[model samples]
Target: MMRSCLFFLVLLGCRTLAADDQPALRVMTFNIRYGTAPDGENHWLKRRELLADTIRQYQPDILGLQECLESQGEYLQEKLPEYAWHGLGRNRDGSSEMTAVFYRKDRFALLQLENFWLSETPDEPGSMGWDARITRMATRVRLYDRQTGRRFTLVNTHFDHVGEQAREQSVSVVVRKLSQCPPPSDEPVLLIGDFNAAAGQSAPYTAAISAGFQDAWVQAAERKGPSITFNGFKPVDPGADNRIDWILYRGNIEPLVCETVDRSENGRFPSDHFPIFALFRLP
Candidate 1:
């Protein structure tokens, strides 16, 4: 199956998305496991190729990445030349892990991009909000789909992994930001990330839904593969309740399909979390 996926990637190398005609948008969210981790043999250098291969196989129109370090981003940029990415680290110096968003450059025109901390002092780059373990941020990009002449806002973020209050507030903060800069009803807004909280959880996930974003996996007509989106680099536990990553949308967007990519090179998965591949169309 892995071979088949690789074969498919080689055969279907990215083609130009014409400026006048695009049917749907493919989106993905992945926590690429920061390069600074001591994963021993499963380190970034050892797994970079497989990581890029995963993107190639999925061929997402836009990809949201969490916990990506500068070195890792450089490697991916070199490997995936067809895609363009935008984001800055959460650190004040912009030298640490970031919530990065990548898109097929030829498909979308980047109109504006901004990054805000998930804290009261949002303008302060390294401010940690509430009881959060570390500084976290959301990268917002306003993109124009030349093919469809559609404009939308895309947000990529990773909420606090440890702070209960921080996670809850993060969702509401994002919602407030979006509401302040409302988009037209037809063009959808997308937010994707490794949210650090499972679906239907009482905190931010609920807040996001209450604010009108639709969960891609939850709304999918067909769910392909395991329920556990985060496997911790182990074989998937059928009984594990590990769905934490998400691809969410608002506006007139419909989720046509959703899939969890579980491809592993040998016993080593690409990341601790499985990437989500979802197709969205404006209805």
Candidate 2:
């Protein structure tokens, strides 16, 4: 009986290991709406649990977040210990809000990570460019998927909300920087975040997509759910249905599914922007 029980335990362990080795990747991009918003009853303290629950429900392998203040990121980190997050703030010394990337540590080995300004001088800390209302930056991470033995790149950014010129220039900078670095023709390169522009209609948004990053929503084999991505503090905002949040990707990957996660429990929203979720697989 003891030997039979030992064999069953070993088989169960192998099954769990196989499940973790699946090749498909689940991705989510969210703009957390900044923790300091004086949202009255929808304050961070009241909605913190909802925010964590939203992520838990989706259970993405990789998550890109915009407008993530240190406190807010730390809060999520505390709530979800399985994910390992890294990204410096868009400041001189990473002292402010960060466009952070969180990944399942067990599934990925972070090969390299960098935080760069969205300006003429990307290496400069806290740099602003082209009439941007505030400083902006992008977080780049090169990850090796231990499960599939595949390596890919992930970038997360938050563009300026007020400056058309700044937003336009920011796209150019990102394209150029990525082109100059990373290996050639890297499959599964993903760019995600809140572009603060109207869907893929604006000039900057167009440029990013034009530079070979296909919008997952547009390329998904099966797409469903609400077209609108941002809903402020209410249940819905048709006027804000711009779909500014995006999950764009490139390389030998097939976008299997794409949709907006717009769930509210007890009339409380996780954030002003509904998270965009996508599933991709190697072709």
Candidate 3:
């Protein structure tokens, strides 16, 4: 009877361990604005430390950064050594650069890395789709959590701001790629970035949602303030409206906590756009 009781206690402990491993995962999306501003000040070098500090405060498991340049990416990696970074290289025009994903090394292991231009031939690198606007692309990464043994795919991108057609086309390309490489049966695909399009009525947002992705902010329990993302140094006040940045998810993962971070306390905006954060749980 003593041996049987001991065995039952061990089994119960194992089940408790498994349950503790499945805690909520925190994810964030921020458009760092290529470390530039209209005032001729605030370069990447000047704001690198501040950005890193703000990010570290949140301690996100995965962070998707849009409008990141190669130099800025290197700077971030150096400043935030706890995370691993991956993304596309710079473009010819030397602007509208790639989106990057920074995953916590101790928490998640990267399974695969893939990137593609958002064009007629999306498989082609640096291929421009419709319109004479700047080129756009998406970076996709598959990550496996060491603690829970759960895996998820994250796709980050920056849609064209000037070209409506290009933005729509870019959304379609991302949807196609995700469909082809769906996340595992038990995992989900989390899409986060600076879409440069508003939610609800915007074509790009509509296209992505139509493809079965749910917006984290919109689906929140309480419809908080306007989904405005681009504060642009304006005072954080009510009625400051815009919804360009987003965190969308598909599959078994559920977003438990969603909030738009107010970085104004830093006495500086991390980027032209505000960052969005979501805490998710896998069943």
TM values, all candidates: 0.90, 0.90, 0.86
Per-residue accuracy of model 1 over 54-141 as CA lDDT, tens digit each: 9998898888899998788878989998889876888888879888889888777676677888998776778899989999999887
lDDT of 3 at 189: 88
Ranking, lDDT, top scorer first: 2, 1, 3
Residue-level lDDT of model 2, residues 1-283, one tens digit each, is: 0000011111111112244354588999998877888988888888889999999999999999998898998999999999999867787867888899999977777776778888888878898988888999998887777766677788899999889998888889888767766545856789999888887579887898788889899899887667788787677654345778889998878888998888888888988889999988764
Query: Which pairs of residues have clashing backbones in candidate 1?
Result: 19-147
Q: Is candidate 1 or candidate 2 better by TM-score?
A: 1
Q: Judged by lDDT relative to the true structure, which candidate is superior, 2 or 3?
A: 2
Q: CA lDDT of each candidate?
A: 0.82, 0.82, 0.76
Model 1 CA deviation exceeding 4 Å by range: 1-22
In the range 149-185, model 3's lDDT, one tens digit per residue, is: 6677888988888888888888888888876766665
Model 2 regions lying over 4 Å from their true place = 1-22, 237-241
User: What's the residue-level lDDT of 228 in candidate 3?
Assistant: 83
**lDDT winner:** 2
Evaluated at residue 205, the lDDT of candidate 2 is 79
Off by over 4 Å in 3: 1-22, 36-38, 90-96, 222-226
